[model samples]
Target: MSQTITQETQTPTVPAAHEAPPRGGKLAGRVAFVTGGTRGIGAAISQALARQGATVASGYAGKTERAQDFLHDLQSAWAGHETEFSIHQGNIGNPEDCRRTIAEVIEKHGRLDILVNNAGITRDRVVSKMSDDDWQQVIDVNLSGAFYLSQAALKHMLERGTGRIVNVSSVIGEMGNIGQANYAASKAGLFGLTKTLAREAAFQLARDGKLDDDTIGVTVNAVTPGYVLTEMVQGVPDKVLDKIKGNIPVHRLARPSEIARVVHFLCADESGFITGQVWGVNGGQDM
Candidate 1:
């Protein structure tokens, strides 16, 4: 005769009230620097990060009045909170300027937790018709500018052992379009830069004995947005704009805030596990 065996299931363990993490924005006490943060997609990103309790340093290459106005609006939107915000003027295409802006932000905020390379420009023309200036200008600002800022910011981040770098690319970079050779190349270059930096950051952390399962190491990632409804896009002819919308599977342009949501998600503390990834906020356009 064999005895019957009984097994009891064990309930999952839960942390005590005192051990649970506090309920609030994950980025509280963090500082973020956003290039081209005065308008369009960049402005949306600045607001998103701010909403998450991050102190924002918005970098602009425009008039002081515009930057001041943006700051006022941002503060007004988040009234009642002792919001800490600032604006930095610099030409992203200039390496020295990039370094200076990063230094300024760190000096003011005591730390830099996030860097968003959102400033970019376009000199649209067919490859045959495009002048050297047109090509060089786009590459300098769109691609080289990102590299400059990242290089400067990474030093602080690696030393701190935690940070997030988010590069704002474009759908055109993934899928080439007519009369946008320069733009396409610059955006596509971000993919390579993002992946390489991610690897380097991890390697350095491990070399410095800072790598561990519990540690959230620095991360670098790229975001590619498709057909956002911005000032430039709105300037297109009605027929052309309609054709563009028709081509998109979503049949509508993306709002700036939608793209910002993805960027904010990547910048969160919980997103440490993700790195060197190319996130497409294109509404099913590039899948």
Candidate 2:
């Protein structure tokens, strides 16, 4: 007699061992690369992204001890969340370093979904007093570094047809702070770079037949934060700091986390349509 096959007799289907289990949070399975990610605002941005379930590759130029401490804290805080964190040492000003940083992240994580060009330096001096080296150094690290990293990340992002790039500019770039000419110019350059790259990303994708209504789009944006309470600002004298705060309508310096919030929003997967925009998080300081 032939026996009828039953549902219980069939083998139950199971997820492949190689497949990653589904994770919670908006950025689950996504990877983010943050420059200068061990200190100040950069550190805040790294934490924000990791909290949302993204694997983070934080780049630092120097300060091994600081980066180690940050990595330890991050891993401890994110333990059991299925999130991974890493710190990479590299000078963002070097194109080769920038390219290698991106390559390392891709190799280790298998993908890069977001890029934050947050590494920057300030050579505070008036044009007449600013030495050539000072100007060049600031420009190299602040403006050119962003370009280098963005250029490297763009190739992969475009091919995948999805990505987010957020440039961290400053209010000094817009208002022109005294003794910060080089810094201002470099930051201002980012505005132009951000807008142009935004257009190019879309154009290239369309040309490659990757553009469509249903596709998760690639976007580039800039966030210009006003005076923030970071090490960069803490050095200012109490009287000067008070004066600066008085100018802000909010009457206080911004927390690094506040700036990170804007970045986190811009990098969200749903923020694809919000490209080439300059978000001023200055507590009405600019307007």
Candidate 3:
């Protein structure tokens, strides 16, 4: 008789529950820290992680009241998980604040498993009209702040032998936009940082023989969103919004939930082998 590959003959034993869908997206019993997570896409990301059974700490740069409100809302949304959600106020643009914020989250949660560098600002102006302050402010908050916080969080993550870092970049970083030189540069810098850190973390894990360990390995990645319907975009004129919408293949702006889902995926164990990658969650927008 000839050996043939048949479903019945080749099938391997599977657990009873394996036939059903997964209970969660492989992120149960994890802790996540999201910077600039009080509103917009950041807030959505926080909620998504909490829903997946992860303790989340959201960092806010200002408006303590709003941050507290966001925390309360998330706590209610994931009430069954005993989800621990809190807000830490600090300017990520400042290195000292970044260090203190990371320390605070680790102290409160006992560990830091995920770090999302989502805090950013935009000072849009033409080169001829832009002031030095406008250029520096955007760079300081968007690019430099990501570096500071990542460095601080990496200290704990590296010690623990595992973590996830997700940097929020912009599509403009790849396809430069008019009147957004500063914003563009900062976002572009994040792309470089994401790749470099991913390599370094992978190297460390390999050296320690932890590269194959699922429970104790780090992955770094970036998510570049295109034309998200956030406070920043609300400032644009209706005509401008229409023009931008026309340029997008999807003919619409990305919902915060959409971007959050991708971030949550990267933070999950299922994405262990995916690092040093930039997942662009643009609504079919080029670049």
Q: Candidate 2, residues 1-287: lDDT per residue as tens digits? A: 00111001011111122222333378878899999887777887887787677899988888688678778777766656689989898987898999999999999999999999998876666779989998999899899999999999999999999999999988878987767788789889999999999999999999999978888789999999887765455345777777777888999878777988899889888887899999998889988
Looking at model 2, residue 30 earns an lDDT score of: 89
Candidate 2 accuracy as lDDT: 0.81
lDDT of 1 by residue, 208-273 (tens): 999899888899999998877665553467777777778778898887778888999999989999
Q: List pairs with backbone clashes in candidate 2.
A: none
Model 3's C-alpha root-mean-square deviation from the true structure amounts to: 12.6
Cα deviation at 278, candidate 2, in Å, is 0.5
Better of 2 and 3 by TM-score: 2
User: What is the overall TM-score of model 3 with all chains considered together?
Assistant: 0.88
lDDT of each: 0.82, 0.81, 0.78
Model 3, span 135-181: residue lDDT tens: 99889989998999889888788888889999998888888777888
RMSD vs true structure, all candidates? 14.6, 15.3, 12.6
Candidate 2 — which residues are off by over 4 angstroms?
1-24, 231-234
**Lowest summed lDDT window (length 10), candidate 2:** 1-10
Model 1 RMSD to the real structure?
Answer: 14.6
lDDT of 1 at 115: 100
- At residue 121, give the lDDT of candidate 1: 80
